[model samples]
Target chain A: MGEVIVITSGKGGVGKTTSTANIGTGLAMLGKKVALIDTDIGLRNLDVVMGLENRIVYNLVDVVENNCRIKQALIKDKRYPNLYLLPSAQTKDKSAVTPEQMKKLTGELRNEFDYILLDCPAGIEQGFKNAIAGADRALVVTTPEVSAVRDADRIIGLLEANEIRRTHLIVNRLRADMVKEGNMMSSDDVVEILAIDLIGIVPDDEHIVISTNNGEPLTGSDCQAGQAYMNICKRVLGEEVPYLDLEVTKTFFQKFAAIFKR
Target chain B: MGFLSNWFKSSESSSDIAKNRLKVAITSDRAICSPELMEQMKNDIIKVISKYVDIDTDGLDIKVTRTELDDDSGTVNAVLASIPIRATKPLRR
Candidate 1:
């Protein structure tokens, strides 16, 4: 049996779908059969980000409505052999699929793959409820900004209410320079407020944008963000991977001063 | 030197401000009680208490705050109400 994990954040545009794509791709690269489900229904972008937009024959709505088989809706990724995507319906709204339907769908998928990742929609509404109905664990994505952290806290409360006990956090778009200058919240600051286990801290990297625009994730490269996702994947698979050092490197003079002080 | 100190004080990073604000906001949000409700409750409490005593309503302080828990306990949400009474009236009088 596979574990179903939902990737969620209460606020939009905080990199939920991007994190899902990268982590799913990273797991596939590690030789695990992975299936990603886009549960954002009316505002689906997982397929576009995964570069499998042109191949979406049947979506989540079709599978739930019994218009197509689950296998028919699964879109195989060309870049990664073991990765697949179940795209969301663009024309249908959140009401197209009920929570029971989502639970059933994820339950069925759980038997076929090693991992099932649900890319949840923003907000704590029906879409959010349906996305987490069948998940075994949750990954709440948030930025270092106050608004994002606030929303993440609300989402964590909701998840706890749902009895999803294994929720962890992923801090995305962290800028080391800004954090060093005390102009932005560090990962530790975010963790302290949320009071959850920290699974990943992705640095703010331009390569993320470039890779997304080109319909490819930065998995098999030396990109900082990609490596962070890779680490998150390993952690998800029960590996004890240390967090990447996200602090700004000290200058030569600073290092010399530190040596003298010691 | 005074101007420099003032400048430095004014330049405290906004990140700290954001964190402090979020701490308060998140605590209040978890309580799930509105400011309007708290005000109404305060008024009701003062009115009830004033019926049998001479009280200073203006000096009353009522707030819904959160208490941090220790390692083995969970955080508690509580209502801290402080009402000052000047004197009590006899029930017969």
Candidate 2:
């Protein structure tokens, strides 16, 4: 069976969908047969982000309702032939699909794909429940803000309650300048409070907004955030790439070098 | 001034003075027990023990130590672990 990885967060607008798209793209770029499943019903954006919205004839609800075959609902990525996307329905709400239905759907896809990436909806509600029902492992995404970290903590507690053990964290929208000025929480502070292994830290880049508007992933670009997302994909693939160091080291030799250079 | 303060802070006697000073100040913030009660407890325990089983009178010492945490019921949390105390020295009149 293929690995089912769910990208989730307790708070909304923290880039769960974007990370899912880019990581799916990154993994497919590595020649993996990946399927991106958007479990965020009524707010489907994975197809748009993957540039496959125009071709979504049979959505996930249609497949679950037996209105269309699973093969018919799955949209092939325009760029990567090996990548497929199972788009959620725009008309129906999250209540339309049950956890058992999601599990059965993903199980069918597991035979044909290497990676089944589930883009979970925000909040620890019904949507979140439906997403992780069939997932093998989870990636909890959060920003460095206190609220986001707090919600992520609650989500981790919920995941543990559900008997999900292998969960990691992805700290998104990190501002290095704010952290340096002690205005924002540092990576150490976030990790300490969340009490989880750090998988990736994507800097807050305006380029993500541009990519979202253009319906393209940043993973194909030369952006630092793209490299971060790619690093997370590699981590999911069981690679041991080190994280990017954002900490500043102040020393006398460096100070003298700066003085002479200036 | 920074290095001068650091030099003064490194002296051995400063630790004793600091510990003595902190023991007086932090105990008030940490608990409802006053410093006088701690002293009274030591004297009462020494006197009460003199009337009963013989204890080292001049050697009897009692001090309040600040604890790191409180119990879940929000009460004073301190363990009265026996200190590796030194033997009392000869008392000069």
Candidate 3:
């Protein structure tokens, strides 16, 4: 049996798709068979992010509508031998897929892969409901901003009400310099507000934009955000990995002191 | 220097302000109680207390707030009511 995890954020553009692609890739790199499902339906972008857009013949709607088999709709990622993506239908809307259908689909995938990650759509709409219907665990992604944290809190409340007990947090796009300057919310601040176990923190990296534009997940790169996603994948696999020192850019005095100590 | 320090002391950083605002906003959101309900509760509390003693009705403070549990366990929200009394009437025997 495999674990079905839903990656969701109530607010849009907080890196849910990015996190889903990178973490799924990282998990596959770790030799785990992973299937990433794009549940956003009309607003599908996971296929593009994974660089599998050119290979998508059948989508989630096709599978649910009985037009194609589940295996036929699954797009095998050329970069990772063990990773696959089930793209959402660009023409169909959220109402096209029901919660029951999603539950059944994920239930079938659960038996075939080590990890099934559902890339959830933004907002607490029908799409969000469908994405989480078959999930065994939920990862609520949020940026270190007041609005994102507020939305994350609301999402947490909804998840708890739905009896999804095993919910964790992934703080995305954290800028350590802003945090140090007391301009941005820190990881501890976000965790305190959400009051859930934190799985990972990905720093703000320009490389993420470059990779996404190139249809390549940053997890395959050597950037700090890529390494962060790798750490998140390890944590998802039930490994104990310490967080990276995102605040490694020390001031002149601090760097000088470190040299003297050496 | 004094003016600069005073200006700094009077204003908080944006992040701190955001944190403080979220603390209150999220607590009230979790409580899910309407403002009218809280106001009615405050009035009832003052009416009950005024029967025995002279209370400052204008000074009454009642709100629903969240309190953290010990050592980062979690948070609990409750209706905290505070009624300030001026004095008690003497009993004639």
Candidate 1 per-residue lDDT, tens place, A116-181, comes to 999999999999999999999999999999999999999988887787878899999999988876
Docking class of 1: acceptable
Model 3 TM-score (2 dp): 0.83
Candidate ranking (TM-score, best to worst): 3, 1, 2
- Per-residue lDDT of candidate 2, residues A1-262 (tens digit): 7999899988898989999999999999988999999999999999888777889898889999999998888888888899999999999999999999988988988899999999999888889999999888889998877567667867776776576767889999988866664457766677765667899999898889888888888885787788888899899899999987655566869978998887
DockQ per candidate, 2 decimals: 0.35, 0.03, 0.39
Candidate 2 regions off by >4 Å? A246-262, B1-93
**What are the per-model numbers of colliding residue pairs?**
0, 0, 0
Q: What is the fraction of true interface contacts found in candidate 3?
A: 0.52
lDDT of each: 0.89, 0.79, 0.88
Q: Can you rank all candidates by DockQ, best first?
A: 3, 1, 2
- Mark the regions of model 3 whose C-alpha exceeds 4 Å error after superposition: A253-262, B1-11, B39-93
Chain A TM-score values for every predicted structure, listed in order: 0.95, 0.92, 0.95
Native contact share for candidate 2:
0.00
2 or 3, which is superior by DockQ? 3
TM-score of chain B of each: 0.58, 0.45, 0.57
Cα RMSD for predicted model 1: 6.4
Please report the candidate that would top DockQ against the real structure: 3
